[model samples]
Target: MTKTDRPDGEDSGHTGPELFEHANEEYDAGNYHRALELFDQAVKKGISNEVMYNNRGAALDAIGRGHEAVDSYLKSVSIAGRYELAWHNMANSLFSQEMYADAVGAYAKAAALNKERVENLSGLARAYLKVGKTGRAVAVIRKLDRFTDKDAAVLLMQCDLYIDAEELVLAEQCARKYLEKNPDDVEGFAHLGNVEHEMGVYGKAVDSYEKALQLTPDDKELWNNLGYTCFLAGFFDKAIGCFDKAILLDPLYKHAWYNKGYAYHGADMLERAVECYDHAVAIDHNDPVLWNNLGNALYNLGRYRDSIPKYVEALIVDPDYDIAWNNIGNALEKMDEYAEAIPYHDRSLEISPDFDYALFAKGVCKAETGDLEEGYNLVLESLDLNPSYDEAWGARAVLAERMGRLDEALLAVEESLAVNSEFDEGWTKRGEILLTMGNMEAAEASFQMALTCLESSHADTAGGLASVVRRGEVLIRLGRFEDALVNIETVVLAGRTNSRMILKDLELRRFMAKYELPKALVEIIRKIAEPGIIAECAEFMVDAGNVLEAERLLSVVRGIPTQSSKLTKAQARIMLAKGETDSALMLLNTSDGRSSDADLLVINAGAHEAGGDFSKAADLYSSALGMDPSNYAAAMGLARLMIRSKKADECISAADIAIGIDSREWEPHKLKAEAYELLNAPGMARFELAQAHSLLAGTGLRPEDIIGG
Candidate 1:
């Protein structure tokens, strides 16, 4: 991203020797400004040369007058079109002005006239890319390959261009080709790593980056990028090392500092993360993202009051950032000021009226205040904005689950993960849905994978009420009841009442305590009615400990009237709490098969299994799986039931499906192990379990989860 400019040289001199000597002296003195004046004097005295114009262009560029520098370089080329340096300088100037077409033509002419010079070819190729002629750029480089002249800068230039064009494949090809001949070219290796990463080939990227790092261990940008890449590739420890190296290389590298903070934040190293963020802020006081990240880290670390100022600082830097406003709203919400959070959400909506994320946040806040009808409407708007947003979908799934729509909840959560497999919250939420649907294996895996990815992805976290609750539910499923309680307490620590997770967590606690509560569901029975518990409420009878009672209640509630979501939610909450997942699921299913109500459906799947109908529940979970091949939650649940039923074929299929849906979730591997175990393949099962263990080790997971009980 360098620019070239013309020098201000004085050409006033008595004779050839004195004049040239004085001019050259001025140029060497780092006095491009003065040299330009001298060069001008000499030109006026009838002593014109291409060197003067080329040198002037470089000088002008140094002084930040790049457009003018292009003019000077063009003049030099006009004086001597065969001058390679003049053409190179001209190309650089044109690039500064984003005049790529012109730059390409000039550089091409220079290279044509002097095929021996590598810079001309490289410059032309880069310009060609900038002008949207990527094929031509690669072709030019291919031709340049036959030339005897080559330099590190030449390879690096092409690397930058290829990366910009999103031609990672081509970039890697060229980089590998260049490295074969120039084995010690650190820049080449570094560029190759970047390309590999862009292509989603993280293992290759890591290898290339390591080679480059070995050569230039002190290169800050390389280390920073490598660290971030590793983080994305689910290798947190390696990412941390790279980021740490980058920070060590250049203490002021804000990106490096930020990345290091993210790594620490993912590791739950709150104090260290805060310190890293502090360093980043100190280095770059104007970056809103850094401030937002800091706010999130603070919030995660239980520094609610401290998070507020960071969000405020972020807003100060980027007043129009909807995400920032959303963050501020979240902080306010955590402080027990739900009403205060509303203003921030309103501001966010003003900036991006159709932003589903903001709308979802707004709805959640409204819902927290007991504005169910209005909140539900806003949630619908959020789904319309981004039907695939995991957060929004998960929210809808929870709602559907509450409404006794297990099938719909599963489908909603699956839809959410389909949009972004990296969304750990979605994975965990999907796991809960799987559990309700009698898909214990997949559900367990979802919970495991969600926690694993959350600790590995090193990305921004969503601070939603449901997000916290999903984690608590996963803990409960794992039989870590105490840990689940602790996580639920953290939800309360956020001071969020009326949070779906809080209600569910409380209900889960009660369920575990009562061990056998009546499935009367008096509230839902008195409110909404439906038919065919399979499509209505069959399992409701089982949950009430009277297999016949849920059936009878289902028949009675069939006339309860749940045309709207509010009534439906009451019924769903009953089904979900009572374990009548199928009855709950049908409440939210749209006639056309399209899911507008995600919350209810996901919860339906969860309640179905909890109610004791494993097979029917698995089918409900499968509806979501059909949409997304790699839906971790559905896979986990399906595998569990398959194992219990000794359906080895289905167990293996579920595990395979979960992995395909999202490799970031380690649950599928565990499920696969169970499938092998049921097939009497202990060796294969152990291997599968080991793989899961390896994946979860760095994710802060306990060892027991990877191997079956």
Candidate 2:
């Protein structure tokens, strides 16, 4: 008779054996309630034993009463310490409950009581692995050879162990070995893919993962692994497809969403990237990396102000996230909020002292905000920390330029180019520095190199406008006026405008007027006129002999009735154009002599030049040139003065300087022609005249109209 059906007394009719039989029957029929009641009766009727407790524990575990099941198994094990089944049952219950430490102890007890059985040892190894006790897990797994001597299951566990140890070669070997024995193991292939991915063999990883998916197509994680491998392989579109499959299978899969965003970003599909990252952040808002990436995409779009808040949110999640801190600093720096950017960079440095980017960013901000020495030192320190950092070297080059250290700037930019010749902006930097140093040939080569790099990619080349403009300026100096006009006109037609637009517009007007294309000059004057360089625009109109348009443009600024020196100068230049020298002098004298503005000095010199006071005009033009070395107007004024005064040698020298400054202007070439005539060199004189005529080929002006005495 079973203990559950034992007779209790006269008050209880059923014996323990009958009750136990009923409980067993109910348990087999899946009636846990009836089984539990019968088991309780058997135990209350003084028929309790380890087997009965073990049976009850199983019923309890099946009914989702894991805590109660553990207690029952403990009761069984306590009653008979040699009950290996009871110990094993308790360990399984504890493992199900996620009480890994207690599960390990119980599994160890079971193994000891059952002569170290394979089942108990395997359970113990899994529990140890769960709790991150890898050493203990390894020891327990070694005992599993009795049951899994040649089985793929043991190989799989070893694969996981080696992977955890970051021994990719061993992990890959085990995964492949397992697949050798169990060719149909879908997970084994996935594991092998994971190992290959860690080893950076993305193509092989994709092959392994594809095999795994073919066997078990619904595995979301396997799909995710394949997608990540594709992303690493630069097959961004294919990666997106894999991620889409994973997302379709599990809508809440955060990693898949996040990875899809990166794939889109890699493909330069920024809007799609932003959408994916936004969805990911919505699902799992605590992931700081997601917020950081979203910020990066915004920054890339030139939405610097908008990117700040996203970076701030990331910082809130993890205050020590150095990259986010550095990113915020960079965005602020771009906005010209250098003061605000400095602290964030400092915070990043505090978190990671060796962070070269943070150092470089802080250095740039400091340099911009007038702390040059400290900023230069910081930038140098960043370069020292990361010698191959091309961007830092670029920053150093710019800072050196700001400090009037052209030689240093050139050296730094060369270092930057050497480190990363493919970086387009580095070439642009080299061109700018060389242009400033008057190395026209080298500067043109650098700018052309940058253009090649820019055209080969979809990168925004508009930011390299200065290089384009500078290259045209050099071409003009080389007497390639037609080529120069084409280059500058292409930039204008592409609808890009900046402060340099004024200079380019001046170049265009000079070229058109000299080429006798009065129509082009009129159109350009109308198109390029804006408040920032309105006065310069008016002055260019006056130089083109468009005095009426110059007066109209100046009238707008003059009507403001403010203390306007540029307006005064533009009006004076126009007055001088109409041969009204006294009116021009009166207008110029309204300004106090305390000012030494380059344009003002040049205008004053123009008044003297127009009045035929060549000597006085030469002095004023020389002063303007002294104040501003790149003053093309002053250079031309002095050149013309030398030609009219019959100083042939001085005329040649001054005209050469003027041409060096702005080769498109016809005045300097005309001045040189007059000088060559005085020297009685008709061949050279005719050459100069032809050069001057070529410059004025399109403009509706003649050589006699400009340089006639």
Candidate 3:
């Protein structure tokens, strides 16, 4: 008869009965993978009536499916509660899973079923040791010592207890004792590795992992440990190889993927890092921090558009994410879409009100979008948030200077240098303003300070290009145009040249200030060079008496192209020159009194006086105060008109305001002469007019050319 069709008597010696024996043979041959499959088949047919689940569980444990093996052992014991062997197998699985409490219970049950089993007593002791029940574990180990010869486990547990109890010397001694008897034991090797790794002895940890791997070549946990130890010891490539092997052996290992990603990042292979993070996310997508890390990797790789959307996606899952909002703002700013960026920064501030970076970003974007006052206020808030944020303060100094608050700009720049003494941009800007104030020696000092600041900063090609170009302009302002050309040509050789608006500003007293063609071509070239440089160049032109160039430059800047405050101000400049004051003011169309186009306002007052409207001319000067509260031009214009109308007190007040704006301007001092003359203050009038004559010497006016000359 066939073995399958044999009766119970025949089956006693049948092939089906031999199935378990064959499974055991496969297991003994070190084919635990194949043995597990055979064991399952034998149990399905109820062939042996032995504790098949316990043997199957042991095979599964060998294959690294420790939790499943534990379930199999429990099932075997359920079918036969007195199965002492099944209980022992269950305890082994629990111990592997680190479920010390449950493992101790299983060991206790096994010992109850077979009171003489020393292995059961040993298992219970190990479980208790893992649970920090060290005294209970030692008591059980002492009972096992009476019968068993396996001192390896007992000595290992004793070492662990010593380490846990802060008895480091004793732990080392016990580890030595265990290793003396079992030099080849993998667990003993792992325990010793842990001790060294925790003590920062990375070299020793690596040696232990290597020795353990040699004894158990297929041990993936050991491989992963060796990789981690090597990584901590700064051997990244070697660690990567170890993690690669661990990942191959266990395809679902999440930690191996994460560690590999970190190693790749350290090597500056950012793209590979992002690729590894993608794998980790696929394995487990719910990790918010992983998503943030992935976004940072993408950003560092210059995939800004890709990175920003991920940050937004992370924010969707976690709305109060300040860092995500900060990154989103950065990407938006890089895109030069500041109008869109400001809201994200505002939201970040809402969540973390003292978030200094968000405050700075919000202000800078506001300034970029043309709300200078609002932007300046936001910058002040940033300073309040972090008083030592030198970059923000330096940027604020630039804003203050642009807004015509020169004294405040100087103070802000000083504060900035106090925070970061080597802020090159701050020193450069402060020097330019000092030069404009005719504080030539102070300006030279500031320019020298810039040299020091630049020396301490990172001077890459871009920074060097910027530095040389700016130094060229500074030299030009100091009437050192020959020296300026050297710096300008350095920029030219780098394929970055033609800065017209900047040249117009630096060429104030030069004969070419009135020239139009050179300025127009330069503006066009800068507009074409980079879109982000366009607004600054345009703003510079608007303030340089070349508003026409500003209008021309904006037409090429794209998106809000062909239109801006600069364009309107340029047209207004023309109308003011033509004695068309009302039309010029109407062209501005400012919604609030916040227009700081001071040159435009000065032009308005000129047009008003030319059109025979002195009263309206005085009001136009008042409007100029909003553009520049300290504008000497606005103050002098109103004072001169008031003197012509023979309004003595009114002329005096207007002159006071003008001198307060800039005591150095001749017109305000001369108007004060007229006021003093009409008031019969002859000595004061002559002294005031003398000061005016001195300031206006080379500015194209003879002494008698003044109204009261």
Best by TM-score: 2
lDDT of 1 by residue, 174-229 (tens): 78767877888887788888888888999988898989988988888888988988
Residue 675's lDDT in candidate 3: 85
Query: How well is each residue in 177-278 modelled by candidate 2, as lDDT tens digits?
Result: 788888988988998998999999999999999999999999999999899899999887789899999999999999999999988776656667788999
- Poorest 10 consecutive residues of model 1 by lDDT? 700-709
Models ranked on TM-score: 2, 1, 3
Instruction: List, residue by residue over 150-240, the lDDT tens digit for candidate 3.
Output: 5457666655655664455655666666787877788878878877776678999899888888888887788888888888899988999
Q: How much is 100 displaced in model 1, in angstroms?
A: 5.4
TM-score of each: 0.51, 0.59, 0.42
Question: Candidate 2 — worst ten consecutive residues by lDDT sum?
Answer: 700-709
Clashes of each: 75, 20, 1
- Best-to-worst lDDT order: 2, 3, 1
Off by over 4 Å in 1: 1-28, 32-57, 67-90, 97-117, 127-133, 148-169, 182-235, 238-256, 284-292, 302-326, 329-386, 396-414, 417-709
Candidate 2 vs. true structure, TM-score: 0.59
